[model samples]
Target chain A: MRSQSEPTQSAGKRAAPPYEQIKLFLKERLENGHWTPGALMPSEADLVAKFAVSRMTVNRALRELQLEGLVDRVQGVGTFAAQLHRVSSSLTIRDIHEEVLERGHVHHATVHLAKAESASATAAQRLGVGLNASVFHTVIVHYENGVALQCEDRYVNPECAPDYLSVDFTKITPTHYLLDVAPLWEARFAVEAGLPTAREAKLLGLKITDPVLIVSRRTVNRGVPITQARLVHPAGRYQIDGVFKP
Target chain B: MRSQSEPTQSAGKRAAPPYEQIKLFLKERLENGHWTPGALMPSEADLVAKFAVSRMTVNRALRELQLEGLVDRVQGVGTFAAQLHRVSSSLTIRDIHEEVLERGHVHHATVHLAKAESASATAAQRLGVGLNASVFHTVIVHYENGVALQCEDRYVNPECAPDYLSVDFTKITPTHYLLDVAPLWEARFAVEAGLPTAREAKLLGLKITDPVLIVSRRTVNRGVPITQARLVHPAGRYQIDGVFKP
Candidate 1:
């Protein structure tokens, strides 16, 4: 039977720092089955005597435990041992280009359109520019291992980078090229579940009305508007996560 | 008028640490118009003469700049100052209860169903438990500010926590109560976009066939089969993100 107490690491009878001793002591107890999840532990005074440490040292160790979500302290009630909640720090959203390269798969891009176009009201408001302004537009399809994975529909403010069309995007991805040209100032993002139209579904090699993941990001570069891109990915193989420091 | 050759801080600084000086030197030159986006930068040899520093130091600085998305380098071709492409971080999916708390809105959950039944094949496989074993199920509608915002359909394995039904869930959130009792071990997640059924939509206060964001998570507790939860939110107000150190 596993104990609920934190495992304590005993330091050989040499003088160890009070804080470290207490941390190890609690850790071993937790691991050795003394304190179980939701089990209230001894009071601060009790622990101070048990560890031959001052209240402040015990408090410091407990404080760290609380921060790590290993224990919950309630007013008037003693601290209780918490169940181990593994908050993973490994989740990440990688750029498609990087992801493809990392998988040792061949990456190819086809830029169907790259030219200046008049902006609609939605585009203008999104770019924070005037209506009908010349906006640089690009329609790109990215493929991995000969399968199309994403369709990037993008709009850029011409005033932000006037020579947008001059660069060849064949060798580098739009994300790679833009990051090189424009330093990102700020960004806004949204994600939604949507059904792709016949055209979008065809491009993604999926059936019509299949559930799709749509990610939209609006970026501002320098003092002018940079670009807004809509990335469409199939839902079966994608998930995103980030850490929170409370 | 910003001139591509306008210099500011990079001029006449030769005594500082080479990397720091080079970074600032490039920054000022870029800011003052010496190096506009897409403009070819001077070769390492040229920078070596300009700052009287080793090529290695200049190379280190340029490498950092490249990683920061400020410059592009081509084999046998010169380096070019790149446009600022915005770097967007991945999003954190907030629990519905947490989101309501963040908005300072009152949150309430109306439990639609809570019962124990023999685990179905699908449920057993998902929970990694024996088929036909007892399992707990819960269906809940979450309201924020008196508006229905989410529907949570969850299932739990009774072997992981026998006292689950004995607790009153109306006064405490399932998440809070479960966290207090059993700590989460590992989680698998999936996200997709879909239209909800008429009943689900009504429960969430969403229009029929409206785009909805659905997230499913299966959590294990200390190697014991625990629970799986599916959460649906109105797409208009919900977003998901995952960030990584790339």
Candidate 2:
């Protein structure tokens, strides 16, 4: 670990504020695993002397890092590196295929159903269409490293993407295809936990009574509804994580 | 229902944009229960004629409403009122007692444990304290309408709030008190579904095999660790909802 006695290598070359430079120094130690999670960090006084900066500067750097969820400081005890958690921003729309690939895991899908159908009352309500409107429906199961991860049932508004029936879903997910053709203008979603239906259980190879994490989403483009989807995953296998700035 | 033939009564007096006016018109209808969920909404042509505005104006109104989860739109079919779901932004921290009161339900809490003790390895890691450091621990169950709603287990770093043990929990929740004394600077959380532990199930009055929704949260203030908390709710009773803009 870089200590207070370490030489001040970049004293005059940097134009950034003292606090910012101190933050970078601390960040590098954390990122490089020199400062492990739960390990005590250098005291403000130590940092101030090492960087030849004011105590306020060191305090500001540490405070900013804490606000970013990067470190945790105790009043009288001292600051310590925070344990890293799965952090996801609610504003970002994540692609499951991309997520799996990023983790260096193989991704595959099994298409169960894909066809054009008259919208049911529930589907009609969610898709913002008149009763019996033509809508495309598809059901697919996604796998990561050969383990079932998600069961997706989606309803697409035909007016938004008339070519929905012709596309091969096995190669490209409905989400990817829609984003390519229609693009998302806005979205709303809800997350809940519940027992899976018999059919859903059978498809996911889970017991009927087993719990599942359910995510319901609706997306719109321009001034038109594009799609509504229900995503289900086995309990204990998936989580939705996030960070909040107050 | 207001029809296309209705005169635009406020046209000359209202200074808002045409689309904003149209949006308010639709919103009032939905809020007053004049239009029920799943009911078909007026078409764009109908809205344009009714508001005496261009088609683009009405389209923008409906599109914005759909993005807000107030309505659903279908391409050749027609727009319809959306079913209301629990929607929350991850950025906001919610108070469970206030949440229950907002639903017009009675809220109460049962305190199980409140004391100061040495931090365990896991607690120490989460709170960024050293081994055997003094930490305050509390366990409480929140009830809504006489049914148990949540079991909260929390650990607080004494350095952040020294009076953690002396507070009257029945009169004031730990969370409420903490926020009052030590406002949060940042927070991270995760939502998962899992089976409750034996002790948790007993406290929650649930069967051992029943699923539960678990939320783990860690919050810091000014680069200092304040608290780490775990909240567990019955699977069918609670959810974490969000809206995302892309």
DockQ of each: 0.18, 0.21
Error of 2 at B140 (Å): 1.7
lDDT of 2 by residue, A78-180 (tens): 9998754322123233566876797799989999999999999988997777899999999899888999888998999998899997898878878878766
The DockQ-derived docking category for candidate 1 is incorrect
lDDT by residue for model 2 over B50-88, one digit each (tens)?
Answer: 777778678878877886677888999999976543221
lDDT over C-alpha atoms for residue A217 of model 2: 80
Give the distance in Å from residue A44's predicted Cα in candidate 2 to where it truly belongs. Answer: 28
The numbered model that scores best in TM-score is 2
Candidate 2 accuracy as lDDT: 0.77
| DockQ, computed on Cα atoms, for candidate 1 | 0.18
Give all TM-scores, in the order shown. Answer: 0.62, 0.63
lDDT of 2 at A16: 71
Name the DockQ score for candidate 2: 0.21
